[model samples]
Target chain A: MPSIRLVDVTKRFGDITALDRVNLEIEDGEYVCVLGPTGSGKTTLLRLIAGVIKPTEGEIYIDGEPASRIPPQERNAAYLPQQYALFPHMRVIDNVAFGPMAKGLSREEAYEISKRMLEMTRLAWRMNSYPHELSGGMQQRLALARALASGAELLLLDEPLGALDARLRVELRYRLRELVKDEGLTAIHVTHDQEEAMAISDRIVVLRDGRIQQEGRPIEVYREPNSIFVANFVGGANFLEGFVHRRLNGSSIIQLRGGLRVRVLDTRFNLGERVVVAIREEATGIVPSSLKSKGGRGNLLPGRVRDISFLGSVVVYEVELVNGEVLNSKVPIQMDHGRFRVGDEVLLSLNPEHLRVYPYPPIGLYRELEAV
Target chain B: MPSVRLVNVTKRYGEITAVEGINLEVEDGEYLCIIGPSGCGKTTLIKCISGIIEPTEGEIYIDGELMNGVPIQERGVGYVFQEIALFPHMDVYDNVSYGPRVKGWDASRMRRLVDEMLNMMALRDRMHDYPMELSGGARQKAAVARALSSGSLLLLLDEPLGALDVKVRIALRRELRRMVKELGLTAIHVTHDQEEAMAISDRIAVMRAGRIVEVGTPQDLYLNPRRLFTANFVGEANFMVGEVAGSSGGEVEVRVNGEPIYSVRSSLLSSGDVLDGGRVVAAIRPEFVVMEGTDGMNSGFGGLTDGCGASWGGRVRSEAFLGSMVRYEVEADNGVLVAVKLPSLSVGSGFRVGSRVTLTFPPRHVLLYPYPPEGLERAISIE
Candidate 1:
């Protein structure tokens, strides 16, 4: 039996619908990351699974049995908020032991479990320190240790490292993932950070406006995003608005605005259907101006460089087409930095295989276009 | 003329020394960024330079004149704080015009200056909107315009985009750099984001513990970091402990554990300088390490065999997909884990965990640093 399961769950807050008929299954010892933007129902989904907030109309099952009657404390799950929320008056060791002690464990047992957890989190040296004396990262680790010491089968973390500095965040992400995997615990983490979700989760469920946008492995979601929003939000994408003109063998020719034609690998749409072709900036490359006259086969556009940004590891160039559409191209920073500048005309070639196409909903049609 | 200069500047608050004995020079129209972690004194340094706070010791000069005696208004410097302090009661036009008005400029001149500043900041369309009505990014741009309306030669920005979202931060960073460059304004921007500082600044000054640790162009800093802190802070690095085994011909072999690895030529250390077979830490960048099959036929560096040039064998322990690249954590024969970043396209399929792989780092990419700085472990522990 799976550790936790939610079937046809829908949550509504008055006139505002937060989650709409969402179904999810988390297996035993699986580390699942619930990823989405702010106010996108990620927290709500976690809350529902944790039994903190009852679903509006659905059944939540644990070990193949309905758990609707179970309260949060008896649900056998741990939920860690964005803030560590440790007791300000308690010392680090006491805070971690609180959960185990509340579960009726003896003082000796609770102390042993808390000490082991704290040691694993690298906070054993600071166990006697109060919450106020601990650093942000240390406090987060203490909260994690407390959650683990609670002896829950499932752990739910809401933006666990959101309050940490970049360096500390990076370090804690690896440590957190290691702890979860080593302890063989099922975890459902909620975060808006795409990189953090991708780095740590076995599978990611990207939520948007109370609905699941896409759920898959990090590579699957990144390489083949299901929608425009997924492509743009997962990393970053340069979107080109176009209509499908023809479907060739395994490839489709897209006719963009301003009479530009692009060959894309996606053939899910019929001819004459408007679609948006999205490509990651790193997938595009720049060629010399002289190469424009060579009559490239497909996926090549003539553009003038609008701006160039040197970002140590990579260089992002903004190129403006004759029709005024802007496209971004990223190259390795080791390449000649001065090779391209603002106002320089260049040819940009996009790999057809890397292009993702989604149906371009008409403007003023619905809010769905921007929701992805 | 030099745009700004600070000589042995120091600042203190009670027992805390925010900035200590800092010296820096910014050229005319140059964009310099001060980057560090929080409490690293980046903001204090910027404040001292912008005349927001007087340095406890040392002098600040702008265009070859002492700026200590001159008030902030007469220092000919523009300052933009992290928070957008626009006058909420006034319209955009009036707020932008306030700087010129306070400097005793006539109404006609102030109007012309405000109009030009608004147009330059791309706020001409919303000149009548109140401060609360503008977007976060737009408000920051307007604040910048207000600073520039008085024709200040130097601009100081303290965590200007610290509160914006990721997308807006990226867009505004490019726009901010362009606006500063287009107007030929010298800028000193303080930020905690290393990438942002690298993306916008012509030069960067990395600070740590109230001192400037390193100063160089972004490329220079990334390619050749002089200090251990700079190497780890600027980007990802794999530090491996090795020893100088021997030198054959022009190549130097550094034996790590039982496996021998070759390093690039270094004139800083001689045969006598290194204790025979003494250990050192080799810092290698993940980008430089190529998978065995990915490089194909060219397995050895510069056509040298016997692992003399640049090669190391490791077993892949874990791998993570980072959108553009796949980062692999490999446990080398030396038992040290090294991370190697390969372009996603280069590896047809991602490397599976526990796959034995041989990695190669080009000679130019490997940096050699002593195993732990002299007397630093004690100092770090004391804090």
Candidate 2:
């Protein structure tokens, strides 16, 4: 178990800055996920911590030692890249055992350790099979088992489950987190998938333009993101431009473009201040406009259903508000039918507590939400 | 637009039969998706439809016209492959207009079509960019737009969005479907992503072991799959081995690990009558499994909570928060591992690891089937 600390780390490639003065600390046995869009410096941060690449400025400390000068092979770290290379000629058991045997353990001791790692990854049944005989999912697990059996306190995983099938990817994420927690190992995972990060990581660090935008627990970052980019990237949200109109007992009323008003559970903004209200797609509820009486207590806005997409578990309805703004509402598929058709007028309900208000950025809303 | 019909189509590569006896029909302007795991012949089936490879046996008809020896260009079919294949020397505009140009279309009409296609794919800003200058997702989107602008009445795509990011893939898949529907083109899409298939396709064909196992609407395949393989493939479902104890009034009592579990008989979507004392398997989707904390106000019997409910004690083994849903794995008292998915709104007040809970499987939600002859594990295996 080792803790990692980065002090003002910066990495530059000629005119391009890959990482810029990032400071972070990871406690022992903690699993931290670095999440970002493409070209957001996620991979660069992982490489710097893995000792594969040195930072251009500042220092990196692993287990309370200066690790910038250390080479990758001597860092007591196992780096599993996106494309894992397994020994084709060796069996699954031998592939995992090779790591321990190279550490000068006896053959029996190495095999014992390898067996336990395989069991944890659900690969023990295929221990006698060659790498070529296993599926893509099995090969990934084998690579992880090999890394774990290497006795490295720190594991750097770069999109370990990128190549898996959709269903297998979901199943493996659970197993991966369980193995890391059970072994009490420190892990830093880098991926462009927001859902994967939210599902497995104890803490998520959102990166953008070679810098850290926000860092917190998965739920905190998802529920209350500090910036518009973090909120949109982690989980897609419906954005509405509004201004603080009035304050009501720790809550604030926001006025929209068409003079429509909505209530939010926030009072940090002053009256008449411009702000944007963000609501999660799933948090928004929808009902037919004819049933206006059923809209009990909440902010109900009249809209027409423009489109509906059934995503198996949930249905996403795109409703065009009377002001011509489109809001998406995700509803679970509970019954067989009775879903709103495309032309039906509907009422969108936004609970005050679910709406998060943020001050308008210097740049426009679209520019601030851009992933690039 | 033309309808496509494949009658007893089979493709063989010496000793290996890639696809066998695949009979499928695509109605005019219908959007059908063929989905399966790798090596399940989904790709091979799409290739056969695209006329890239001649089937070893059977007949293919486009608009009731025989197409046994017709060339791909004469078929009037647009093909988009999983792999990137764009003209290297041409820019995005030229590549999208290639098909219309070859057909001797006028400049103004061709330009209008190309512009519309580019705008729909969000590649208008990159119209002058070459394939090498675009990102992976953008290149794939361009490839799709090129195929759509070709004026082909039939479209056959093999995992067109497989290489895109998750967010991009979701957005592009919806756009792709909308364009196909608006243009009134009959399409057959092949992919391994079940969610993508469910989201866009008018009908889904579940392929397995070089054969079309079942074909139905997305809702039918997901809720009332005729085969156990489809239930395991389309979504997450928990299966328990049991023996049928008795049946009455559409409800069957199954003995799972010596505990009585009630399930719906008609939910099996089968014809045969279930015999008592016969081995059976109970399947339930995670969303249908109701889990309640034991410390809550109401307490019921450990065995049966009501007339149609079967309750059991369990301990939460693990929990995964998946944005909209919270999935929990529980170890039941009968030694069966059950998965339950609840809306994430209840996450804060939900059961945690090692919390004792009551898992209730409503009879209406439980599906019953005769234990697969090949065993439950083999029956549910995708490979």
Candidate 3:
């Protein structure tokens, strides 16, 4: 049996559907992240798994046992929240040991367990300090230590590092994963941060409007998202509206709305079928329109630079194609800086390997394209 | 005239010194960003400049005029806060026009100005949308337009884009910069994000414990930092211990783990900066180090002769796809793990863990700082 399972679980807050028929399965010791922006019902899903809330319709099972039959306290799952969730009045050690002590461990045993968890989170030095005395990151680590000290095989984290700085978030996310795996814990973390979800999770469950949009490995969702939402949400993507023109050599030739032809793999489309071709911002290389690139170019589109911005490690060039299709290319900072400017004509070479083709969405596909 | 100047500024709250004595100059129409970690007094410095709070012991000047006693409004400075404070009842158009209306501008002029500001922010289409109906990014743009509508001589922004998503922040920061530069509005922005500071600023002031540690262009801070904090804060760097072996012409030979490593002697440093056999730290960006012959689709790197990148063999320890860049941790022969960053575009990230490869980089990107550096541990805390 999977460690946890959700069979068409749905939750409603009066009229609004917070989570709509969400189905998922978490294997033993697997790290899964429920990722979505605000109002996407990520928290509702985590709460449902921890038995904190009941589904308006459908079932949830933990360890092959129906979860609704179990009370929240009997779930034996540790829940850490975005608010640090530490006892402000208690010292760090006591807060971490609170779980073990309440779960019937001896005083000495609880202390011992807390100490080990603290060391794992690098919060051993602050064991004697109160929660308010620690930095935001330190407090977050303390919360993780508390969750680990509880001896729960399943750990549920809700936006665990939302309050920390960017640098601190990067450093602690890996540490959190290490602590979870080393303890042989099955974890389900929820967050809105795309980078945070991609950095630590073994599997990502993308949710929107109370339903699972897509679920896959982080890289899979990023490089080849199954839908338009996943592509734009996980990473920056360029969407071009096109139709399948023909099939040749195990690939489909796509014709853009402007009559430019490009080749793409995965031949699951019919002739003249309208599709949206998704290309990642970093997959395209830019060059002056006058010079041809040595890299084999299968799809070169000429465009005038519409906008360019310096982003420290990278430069983002927003090129508007001659046919008025806007595409973005992210060039690394190490590349020559003065290559292209606004109004300068440039050619974007798109590699076919990075192209992802999907049937045009039923509604609001154009709206989402502009948002991406 | 200089847009703003801080002379020996310091702010103390009770027994704690929020900002130490600091001096800085902002040129007219310059986008200067002040950045540091929490408790570093970035907020206090911004407040002192904007007259929200008084500096305990220093002088502030705006446009060459002594502004020590000038009121916040009379100082001709517009301060946008971290959180968007839109008038809840007003629509986007009215919220933007509120500034001009408050200044008693004629109805026609106010309407025209609001339209222009909305067009510049790309919010003209959403001019009729309420605060609740707009996304966080749109609301933020409305707030920026409102600040711009005030038409102050100087703009003080305190992490205005801090509360948005990564992609939204990236998009809005550039727009903010474009609007600021197009309007020729001198601005001072404060943020804890090094990337944000580097992206939008004409110059950056790195703060530590409320004091100005260093101020320079983003390229200067990224390429040749005067201190370890500035280097690590602005960008990712691999810090390794080394000793100066010999110097000749434009290159200096530094020894790391008994291996000769040539580094370009930075013209920014004093000529006698490093003496022979003196210990120092070599800081280099991960992207500067080139991994040799990574030809497969996994990583499109290939064809580098021995002398191209001061070469060394290393095994791939681990790798991660950080969206924009692929980070590979390589364990060198000396038992040190060097992190290399490759653009996520061309490189297919085919490098597998445990693969053997050679690593090398040009001597010019290497930065050698004095060993046993003063306050280095405190400045660039790895934790």
lDDT at residue A338 of model 2 (Cα atoms): 48
Identify the runs in model 1 with alpha carbons over 4 angstroms from their true place: A97-128, A134-138, A148-150, A245-250, A268-272, A292-295, A333-344, A364-372, B69-74, B90-94, B101-135, B248-250, B265-275, B293-308, B374-383
Candidate 3's DockQ? 0.49
The i-RMS of every model, in angstroms, reads 3.3, 3.2, 2.4
Better of 1 and 2 by TM-score: 2
Give the lowest summed-lDDT range of ten residues in model 2 chain B. Answer: B297-306
Q: For residues A196-248, what per-residue lDDT tens digits would candidate 3 score against the true structure?
A: 78878889999988889899888777876888888888886888988999988
What is the alpha-carbon lDDT of model 2 when measured against the actual structure? Answer: 0.86
Instruction: Give the CAPRI rating of model 1.
Output: acceptable
Cand. 3 TM to true fold = 0.91
lDDT of each: 0.79, 0.86, 0.82
lDDT tens per residue, model 1, B177-250: 98888888999999877888888999999898899989999887887887666777777777667788776565
Best by lDDT: 2
List model 1 lDDT by residue over A245-331, tens digit each. Answer: 999999999998899899988889999998888888888878878876676675789899988777655778899987678889887
TM-score for chain B of each model, two decimals: 0.89, 0.95, 0.92
DockQ for every model, please: 0.44, 0.49, 0.49
* Residue A108 in model 1: lDDT: 92
Residues B14-48, model 2: lDDT tens digits: 99999999899989999999998878899988887
